[model samples]
Target: MAKEIKKVVLAYSGGLDTSIIIPWLKENYNNCEVIAVSGDVGQGTELDGLEEKAIKTGASKLYIEDLKQEYIENYIWPCLKADAKYEDYLLGTSHARPCIAKRLVEIAKAEGADAICHGCTGKGNDQVRFELAIKAFAPDMKIIAPWREWSIKSRDEEIDYAEAHNIPLKINRETNYSKDKNIWHLSHEGLDLENPANEPQYNKPGFLELGVSPEQAPDEPTYVTIHFEKGIPTAVDGEELGAVELVTKLNKLGGANGIGLLDIVENRLVGMKSRGVYETPAGTILYKAHNVLETITLDKETFHYMQSQIAPKMADLTYNGQWFTPLREAIGAFVDKVNENVTGDVKLKLYKGNVINAGVTSPYTLYDEEIATFDEDEVYDQKDSAGFINLFGLPIKVQAKLKAKNSAE
Candidate 1:
């Protein structure tokens, strides 16, 4: 019921599902040239052999774009500024998908590709993410999802297909857990994680490489100072660095101190529950530091309102893969306005996975030392509270007086 696609650009990651997808698309789509595009959004050195892997597995060509800078400056920073955390998560994996999908659309248009394909499963949020971004950018582009169309039901079937087609896969029987990794965080799912009652052995050291185990962390405390200007992190300790460098430094320092580790069962947009372990040391540090700075910089009412209303919506939008939509952009505009004076410095002590706030200060701070002093102060009058309390409790006093008079009568 769809138009015939000549050449397809597939968002390939060289995983089990994507490996089989390359050969599968070629076989089914009349042997179309499947151009593979992998977005290098801080996957580290894992991009080394990705191009070769794609080509060998029947891709006509491969495009690996370095999106680390864009990812940090555009996507991650905006979410961080808004304090966008989905169900208390920093939205590590979800935030990266839109940027990657956008690039895929760009590559498709440049190559005159008839269709865009992905390996996302039918039930997952990524299928919605990749497709929505594609639709947002290039509405007319034909979308192909192999998992929705294919007869393959299990990972074993995918392995068999890859073997038959000579497609190299990175998965094995031992490392059965499926993971999505980026600079922000790493997500673990599948296997035992599907069952909520199963005790996750995240404590096993070397089980994952993102950060150290809490038990394995050093007993001695590590101190770090974060400097922020308008809610954007500008420096670490006293050294000024760019966005990439600062996050990398914090990741190393925080990871060493075991400062980030999370286990949560979250509700997916697709109406299913998923349990995942995320390690985001740098993100954890950044969130805490930003929150501390806001305490000094933001006014009580506006800050509390934004915290209660705007923050959760931003988190929900990011988690639901609505990054490229107008609502998110509008929210970002509001967030930028609110963060205009959020400049400050926060000193923290990290010990055995605990990040304790030592102190926070800012030039734009609303904390008036003169008014808050218990000792003699000139700013606030002590007698003003009597009149203020009388007016404040007028309704209560009137109600009680009326009730007493009626009872006496």
Candidate 2:
């Protein structure tokens, strides 16, 4: 026996699962008014006519909040600065969840709703990300997870529910390849992807929005220059752009050259391994370019130290849904300090899916052409290496000498 919920703000996406949740919530909660809150984070056409669809499916009202800029600047930029890639994933979908869930909480408070709901499946990591974000933001707010509570077990059941309730869905959209998209990246799962051994068909219908198959890419090389200021990308190809636009511009260029396609079997936070193919054209370019700049700007010790923590910190923060936590904030401060002189231009050559670094330059570059030149220069004395090597290898020499003395005795 659960307490009665008068109203709930559903984090709706106008997708199959969310479309059904509207009617399902009403039925379970004695016909409660479900207010749909759709956070638009560069989902493109997915937001088209969302309000009408929500209202027709039994939602009392719909709130379409444009969170694209906030999503890019607040969420995406922080993760990018931290180089936060979960298990080598750019975390496009994982990072966006917290922003969405936080917005859901804001909508819940604004609407004075009794509970907040999301359409995450019980078997997936998103449920944890979404719920934990909700908990962090609104500790007292009731969370209604339909997948965990309701009897609707599969996509078939959800589609059936949608039909019975006369909820309009995109009939042409193929359900074979389940996908999630945002400005940063697009993730593909389900269908043939469920089996790890099955080779992904680039020719699969409805696939390849951000990239052509590597085989289909142009044979010619494409070069693009990315400009950075204090580690954050400010412009691409001389055009100053905002966070979303910058990513969008780079995604187009990277995809044209078959740049950012990754197939990996990753450890999900829910204690399971899932295989997914991710296309992160813009993210890939940014990552490679940023690292190139940091090479010249960051000291060897600091760079290596931060490099060691990049993966683990990314996994813990992204997986645990602590995108806005103090720990992440502290890490960001350190990363920012490391990027102080990361200001520079990186020219990368994209050829048949490979992003090869062409050239890099920075005002703070520690590389001295005169000192590093192959030709002779008056910069240093070569004989100094004798004393330096002796000092450097002193401990090893002493240990070896002791071993020889002991053997003789």
Candidate 3:
């Protein structure tokens, strides 16, 4: 016997898995009233007709929350400031999950729901991300993961179940990929992407949603200038814009030049390796520009330490759905302090998927031309290096002398 659930709030995306989840929850949870919640993190037209679809599919009501500005300013900017990337992959989907789940919990509470449900599959990392976030926000809320409990074995089976229940679906058996899209990035998985040996069909029409293939990009290169204030982007190409507008503009420029495309076999939190293709467009360009600016703005020790130590850990924490944890908040504080002087502009040339660093300029730059130049300077004498080298090599010189003395003896 299962515990009775009267009502449930679902984190709906109007995607295939979520499309049928409304019906599945009502069928299994004693006909519980389902309230659908969708976070609009720059998914654009995907949210169009979502309310009608949700109502038709048995949801009592649909809440489409506009989280675009919040997603970029709070979530995306923090990740950028920390320079968080998992295995060289821009953590687009990983960070977006927490933002969506947080909003879902809020809606669940407001709706007076007994439980929160999601369409995340048992085998994927999303289930862990969603559940961990929900647990952090509302520990007492019951989590109902249909994929873990239901008997559906494959996507084909899920489609059949949806058809039998007359649940309208936007996908069919011919659907070749499982994709998640937001303002930050777009990810593609399943289908031919499952086999690591198969090369992605980048040339195929409709293969990429964010940008064209590098091969299809124009021959002429496009130049972009990104301005930053304390590690947050403020403008592009001399046009000052807000967080959302800046990213949207960059996405268009970078995508047109075929800038941000990646295919990798990444390790999932569930202890399995999965292949995914990602189109980051704007994110890739932004990360590049921010990093270049940091090169000039941050001191040697802090910059090197951030790149060597803080970045990887930050990436892991973000990817693991620990955004609400105190540790992540502390890390954010550290990143914020480090970014106090990271105000600058970076110019780049986008050509055939390459972000070439054209130049970087900053008022806080620590680089001293006179000190670094080869010509004679009044700052100091080059001869001072002799004494410094002698002292620095003293231990090595002593060890060598002792070895020689012992060998002779």
Top model by TM-score, which number? 3
How high is each candidate's TM-score? Answer: 0.96, 0.95, 0.97
Q: lDDT tens digits, residues 1-409, model 2?
A: 2347988999999988898999898888988889999988878888899999998889999999888889888887777766767778888888889989998998899889999999988878888888888988899999998998998887877778888888888742355466787888888888778899998777665688888877888989999999999889999878899887898899988998888999999988778889999999989999899989988888889888777886469557886677677787788787778778889899999988899999999999988888888889899778999999999999999999999999999
Cα lDDT of model 1 by residue, 1-409, tens digit: 2337889999887778888888898788888889999998888766779888888878999998988889888999898888888887889888899999999999999999999999899888999888899999999999999898989998878888888887766677667788888888888888887788887676765555777877778989999999999999999989999988998899999888887888889999999888988889999999999999998888898789778988899988888989888999999999999999999899999888899999998999999888899999888899999999999999999999999999999
For candidate 2, give the lDDT: 0.85
lDDT of each: 0.88, 0.85, 0.91
Distance (Å) between predicted and true CA of 162, model 1? 1.9
> What are the per-model numbers of colliding residue pairs?
0, 0, 0
Clashing pairs in 1: none
The lDDT, on a scale of 0 to 1, for candidate 3 is: 0.91
In candidate 3, what are the lDDT values of residues 169-215, reduced to their tens digit? 76767764898899989899999889999998888888898999999
Q: For residue 30, give model 1's deviation from the true position in Å.
A: 0.6
What ranking emerges by lDDT with the best candidate at the front? 3, 1, 2
Model 3: lowest-lDDT 10 consecutive positions: 167-176
Please provide the root mean square deviation of candidate 3 (C-alpha atoms, Å): 1.3
